[model samples]
Target: MKQRCVKPRFWVVLVGTLGLAVGCGKAPSPRFDSNLMVMDKYDISFEQQQDIANALAALFGTPDDPYVPKESGLDKDKIKLAAGPTKSDKAGVHTGLYREHCAHCHGISGNGMGPTAAFLKPYPRDYREGWFKFKSTERAEMPTNADLERILRHGIPGTSMPAFEVALVQPEIEALVEYVKYLSLRGMVEIELARQTSEELGEGERLPTTAEFLVEGVLKPQAEKWSSAETKLMPVAAPPADFGSPASIAAGKSLFYDVNKANCLKCHGTTALGDGVLNDYDQWNKDVAEFRTKADATLASLTEQRGKAEEDFATAVEALGADSALSEEERKQQRETLEKDKAATLKKLGEKERMLPTAMAYTLVPRYIEPRNLRMGVYRGGRRPLDVYYRIHSGINGTPMPAIANLVADSELPADLSEEEKAQRRQSLQTQRMWNIVDYVLSLPYEPGGELGADISMLGRERN
Candidate 1:
């Protein structure tokens, strides 16, 4: 051909290859399109994707560090099998490593959350957070190795943390443990520094120690121990225990609604409905919350008001139709022709969140907490009903977890505590009842068999 546009052909190859790489076009350029193979979209490599998936899978695993040298005694770099810590510098190095590795979701100091924050729920702890919510062996504190291990071994089911027992080796797990303790210790130290650095009563005055992050009690051992590179992580103690008994459960039931125990009826109401069907402890308050000042709300009210709105919308739509008042038959014909045009004018009202909606999430009564129907003892949290029992016992932080720590009489219970001695015995029984009730509560959400509820794991229990 007559000097076949060699110049154009040369430029086509160069432009196709270089244009996508240099971002010469505007934003939303067709660079990501498979047609443009010059560069990879999202700048992510295949390896990185695998890593990200691995990282996500790890989250759903045990929430605790997996490595605590079993009787076999573990050390990776040194490979020495020993029960106690070998090197002290290793402790400090491990501490620093935790800040880089574990702190994000677990907290800047292993409190649960470092940088990958905001994207998680059951939100990361403050580290300076409380301990011993349920099935706790320690009076109250961050879990011992035993507690942490169970969480790590099984991984809280529904949560993002996953089990790592398979992917991570036992020795690496030990390294992680040392690292976590270091973070906890480091966090404790940071709190101390913050206090010491605070502009207190005077510039020179040292910040007095409260409970932790101080010289005396909490951080002292940590500091001394870390200095020696004491890699010895304390063993986590087993904390699980059984629910009280039938009598204790009955006692707990009384306290659940009664004034003596927690006096929950004030907010929860008599029938367990936020509605005060049994009595009026909070008549005005309930009215204020559920109150909607709009002109029409009830279905009866909607039945009255539907005509005008639909009629007006239909009138406008009829602009495209041959006849106006949209007869039933004609409307059905038009509906078949249009999809998005429907629901264009109907104004719907959704329940407004509380003035302090998030706050109310904590204060809500147990009835509103929304129990998932359980097919078996295994909850999304884990296999143990005791887990929920612990949650109930300790009460979830920051909200209305309803601390049944102290049992009381139900508002529904006969108000007849005539004898003080009887009351004391009842209180004792109520305490027991609290534990039983929790078990019963945990046992709930199981499928109901006839009038009786059956375990969902036994759903096939139905003879039919």
Candidate 2:
């Protein structure tokens, strides 16, 4: 296993505190002739590398960081992990998800400039502003990756972020974090250039921007750094539990219905077939109706809504008039430039429609007719643990999936409490019966299997 050493904070001046500098008292940072502190902070020194290794001992911790614990998400473990999965690979998987699902709103670069970004609110985490809120107040003062995982699983109430665990597994959700971190880091670098240009050229002239600088210098270095980390973190695929053990399958069955835990049967049903109870629609339908009634469900409506908001913000700025007057000429010019970005963002969304795979997408509806049963995930929209996790947290926005974090955190459970928590109690009961029921369910369909035969691959041809 490659040893992990944390990188020093690249933006040293940004978080400039020297308390950890060990005996290096309140000395001011030595002046640089022309060097920017952000770039210089990254210079790798042997001593600094040692410091990073020490700092990361919690992340690359002795046994593990309890703040963010890890476990086998596999149904039955077959592959043995030596050092455990690295953070980069886990994040890369989510990067792919962004490419598939989120890039439309979050943008490939996560700059809140996705094709649909102009239409969204709070404008997708400008990622460049790397101010993450989920921090630990504990004396140790570090947040776990698990906290991120929880947010992914339960959508934050009153916001746009959605729960995603149902669609992503624990490892896959980990992958999303790495991808976001990559984008966030990139955004930070670009924002630095913006800050510099705004200062240097006095905000009139656009500063130096080079295709080569973007492609060859910045993008290439980042890819190299990230890909190297990814290869080091690729996790071993887990092996299935020994099928013949009987006891293992029995345990898995018990886990399903054991209650107080993964009460999957509530939505999945007792037959392990889609026969279980499902949650009733809550306020989602009403919200969708109200939203669509006033605003079109199509992308065009969202675009219009956002455009109006921008125009309003501009008007508000203009209304500052003499109350907060900028010189007349300066105000006019700033207004023009501000309008350009708003227009650009809106135009970006309209153009993305051309990229939609209308032909292949529609043709695939019934095309080859592959019968892959993926009902284990009933969320319908997604099929991975991370998908479910994100869905729960982010909610369906206009849908019934409410932001569970706020509800649970603030006891927002309606006093009406749908069905008086019928699903909760049902879920608990189902969990209690999980493992044994699954064993029996699987056994019911058993036919002799090859090689290991009756005890092993029960439903297949026997071994010669």
Writing each residue's lDDT as its tens digit, candidate 2 over 1-464 gives 65443233321222122233423234322210111122122322223223322322222132111112121111111111111222235444222354554555665445444666555443444443343433221211212355445666764433466778677676656656655554444444444443444344442344334545434443444344323432332112222344335674565444444343344344434434433433342232232233333322434566566768688767856675544558878777777777776775555444332222221121111111111112222233333333433333333432222332211211433455576485565443333233233343344334233311234322222111
Any idea what lDDT model 1 has?
0.38
Flag regions of model 2 displaced more than 4 Å.
1-253, 261-264, 277-328, 338-442, 446-464
Give per-model CA RMSD: 20.7, 20.1
lDDT of 1 at 324: 64
- Per-residue lDDT tens digits for candidate 1, residues 1-464, read 44332322122222113233333233221110011110111222223223322322222111222222222122333222211222236444322333333455765334443455446543444343223222333223354445555655566664566565774456545556544444444444433333334323352344343433333543464444433332332222232254445554444456656676555444434422232233322321232234322211333355444565567656756664656677878776676544333343233311111112222321212112222233234344355645654555554433344445455445534567556766766665554554555655443334245423332224333211
TM-score, structure 1 vs. true: 0.41
What is candidate 2's local distance difference test score?
A: 0.38
Q: Which residue segments of model 1 deviate by more than 4 Å?
A: 1-104, 128-135, 138-140, 196-201, 204-218, 221-385, 397-402, 408-431, 447-464
Displacement of the residue 118 alpha carbon in candidate 2, Å: 30
- The TM-score values for the models, in the order shown, are 0.41, 0.26
